[model samples]
Target: MELKLYRAGWALALPAVRMLLARRGRGAGMRFLEERLGRDWQARAPGALWFHCASVGEVMTACPLVRRLHARGAAPLLVTTNTPTGARTATRVLPGAVGHAYLPVDTRRRVARFLDRFRPRALLVCETEIWPELYGACHRRGIPVVLFNARLTERTLRAPAWLARLYAQALAPVRGVLARSEGDAERFRALGAHRVQVVGNLKWAGCPADPAGPPPSAVPYWAAVSTHEDEELRLARIERMLPSDAPVLALVPRHPERGPAIAARLRAAGFGVAVRSRGEPPAERIWLVDTLGEALRFMAHAELVFMGGSLVPAGGHNLLEPARLGRAVVVGPHMEDFAQETEDLVEAGAVVQVDDEGEAGRTIARLLADAAARRALGQAAAAFVAARGETVLEAYLAELHAARLPLDRAPA
Candidate 1:
């Protein structure tokens, strides 16, 4: 009864979804609508491997796997993402993908049409994208639906009963679930995902090869990455507390549009600031990285890194990125979304956790003053990430082969 109501409600919401997409702008939004409505779009190839990454973060996590699949001759892979940024990253990073597009709204008919058109041999849903209609449609067609790098937070597990039941039902058709941690695997099982396996996180697979040419900036700096609203002001305060001779501070907000506002705020607060998008780095004390896909680049050159999102309630961005880069890392108290990984890193002494803005300032100052401590932290972080190895990706490939999925190395 509840499932029927959900289907009805989703069907009724399709028109509103179309209007929202149209309002977002024409480029990818219009293209997405046209494809969903069964006009002006075609799949690059039938029986392709399909991967869905919801946004930029997921795109990063999916890139390595996509590259491995392609190298093994899984040609004509189809990638779909809900955000334009994700789509762009997918296209840029996974050049082997036959196509990249916004995922269609999850109405029954639209999902069925997508399945019929693409005819993917298997569908890989990246990190917490549970679309009931799409899963059901693929299941009916006998296509394997695997959840890759899956994670479930405590809040999600303890959601209101009705929503929890809906999620459980939505996850029912997944053939396999590769969780990021054992705790996440348990949550998926509690939410009705059968065959859950603890495959660890693929983000630990390691950082991308260095970009060709010189580093983005040669000056030594401290990086504040993926910061959320008001976190910049807090970071500014922390900067003021650092030693007078400490390296420059690079402020990289999670959203590029916020760069101007952040720069203005820092300047208004009487700090010397330079925006990266405007061109060359300044000799100012603060350099605002007003761009995309360059956070890792900045982290690579930093004396230390303080990941954002944790200062506020944004569940924190990936702490592993900086750790993988072998940079001394600092985060705040609210890393609940990355609970398992955060705890493990903290236990290994690879990351420093502060309880508040004041503590963050003190911690940064202490690390900056003691170069030896920074080196120790960085070395520990790199080693901790390296210890995870490639077990996760290997497990995923083994499962895919065992299921008799089509692949270059699989028997014809």
Candidate 2:
């Protein structure tokens, strides 16, 4: 009953949704709909393995799993993403994929058409994308579906009964749900997922090898990464609190387009700033990394790293990235999105936790002043990450093998 109502509502809402997507400048998703409506999907390769990633972070988290699938002879991979940035990253990182496309809209007819055209043997969804129509279409076609690196927050679990029922129905068709943590696994079970398992976060599987390039700067530096609005001003003030001989600071905003404004603000605060997009390096006191896909590079040269989005109300970006890079890490108190992971890290002495910007400054200053302490923190962080086994990927592979899916190697 809930499923029928949801389908009816979704059908009625699709035209408005399309208009909203166009208004929001999601040209790639719009183009995909146009092509599908024109029956252009008939021209693409069929019966490939399909993976769907929602955005940039999902793309990064799915990268290692995609590579493993490809390495295991999963030929003719197809990657579908909801956002242009995700599509671009999929194309750039998973060149082995036969093609990339925007995920078809969630209407039953459109999703059915996509399933028929692609004829994928299995569908792998990253994170929390629970589309009822899409899952139903796959189920009707007898295609297996799996959710990897799955997470369900408190907000989702506590949704009203009707909406919760809709989610339960949507998740019913999924063959397996490999959750990022035990908490997530319980939530999936609560939503009526049948074959849920607690698999550690796939983000811990590993990041892509650093590209071959010189360090962004020779000077010792500290990096503030994936920062959100107003975080730059707060971080710059924190930089002032550091001792005169502290390492240079690198500010990498979550949205690179904010670079010019961030640089201007930092300059107004009496600090020398250089914007990376403008070909500026760490020559100044603060180097604003106004680019994408280079956070790891900047992190490599940092004495310590501050994971952003936490100081404010944002749920915090990935702390594991810097931890994997063996950098001493600090984060503010608002890590609700990563509550379990952050708590575990703090308990293990793998990270420094601060309540506010002022505490962040003082904590960073103290860590910077003690080289031995910084090194110890970095070591603990790296070790902590290493201890979380990559058995999730292995378990996924075993499941695939038991199911006897096609994984013939693709041509090099």
Candidate 3:
């Protein structure tokens, strides 16, 4: 009943959704547009293990699993993501995968077209993308679906009844769930997900530091990374509250496409800014680190780092990205998305947690005054990440074996 209503709603919204997708996908190329619209694009051979990632974050998070699958399995692999950035990352990170495409718009008709194109043996989803039409179609077709690295936030679980009904219906069809935490498992169970298990965060094992790169600029620089909308401004303000000269500020917005607009705002606010996409060097006032795939490089070079998305209730990005780089990391109080990591790191004195940007500035200021103190914090973080070991992948593979999924070398 709820599925019928949901489909009806999507039917009404389909035109607008297509327009939004077209606008967002500008310059992503004709193939990108066609694949997303449920037409064109190369078809996959039957029986591939299909993975759907929502965007850049999920694609990156799934890197460890995808790489493992690519290395061990003879079965063809296909990855579909919701955005162009994700497609580009899949091309970069999971180059061995046989095919990558945008996930079709999530109406029954479009999703059915996509399924017919791929004919996947099993569907593995990353994180919290719940599409009722897609799930219902896959279930009706008897395709096995597993959600790994899954998380359900408290706010989402407690959504109003109509929305919750749709989610419950979507989850009911999932064959298994590998949750990131026990709390997440419970939340999924409450949402009617079956066969849920706490397998720990895959990201903990996925994103280790890359070999350190040359400094982003000659002067020492610090980064506020994965920042969402006004967060770039908010974290950039940390400079004003600093006691002495802060390191050159790299304001890395989460969305690279927003770089030009963000730089304009920074300039209007009386800060000299340079856009990375424009080949602008670090400006005197603020160097807007406006490119994809380089946030970690800046973090690795900096004496201090701040993970964004926390100060403005955007939950927060992965803290472990910089932590494993042995950089002193700080974050604001609204890290609900990474609650466990935030708590563990804070308790261990590995990451400094503050209530707001004001506290963040003060926290960073004190750390700047004492080089030894910064090193101690960074070392603790790196140690904590290293101590986590490599269990998530093994356990997740075990889950696959137990589920009768053939992940070993494909049948001859």
Q: Candidate 3, which ten residues in sequence have the lowest lDDT sum? A: 403-412
Candidate 1: global Cα-lDDT? 0.81
Residue-by-residue lDDT tens digits, candidate 3, 1-412:
7777777887898789879888998988777778888876665556678889999889888887878777775468888998988888788777454678788887777899888877777888999988888888889988878899998888897787887988987888788899999999999999888889998888877643345588778877778888888887776677766654667778888888888888788777777787777788875657888787888788888888888899889889899888988899999888988999889899998999999777788888898778999999999999887676367777887887787765543334
Q: Model 3 Cα displacement at 289 (Å)?
A: 3.2
Error of 2 at 64 (Å): 1.5
How many Å off is the CA of 16 in candidate 2? 4.2
Quick one: ranking by TM-score, best first? 1, 3, 2
Local accuracy by lDDT, each model: 0.81, 0.80, 0.82
CA shift at 108, candidate 1, in angstroms?
2.5
Q: lDDT of model 3 at residue 178? A: 91
Q: Using lDDT as the measure, which candidate wins?
A: 3
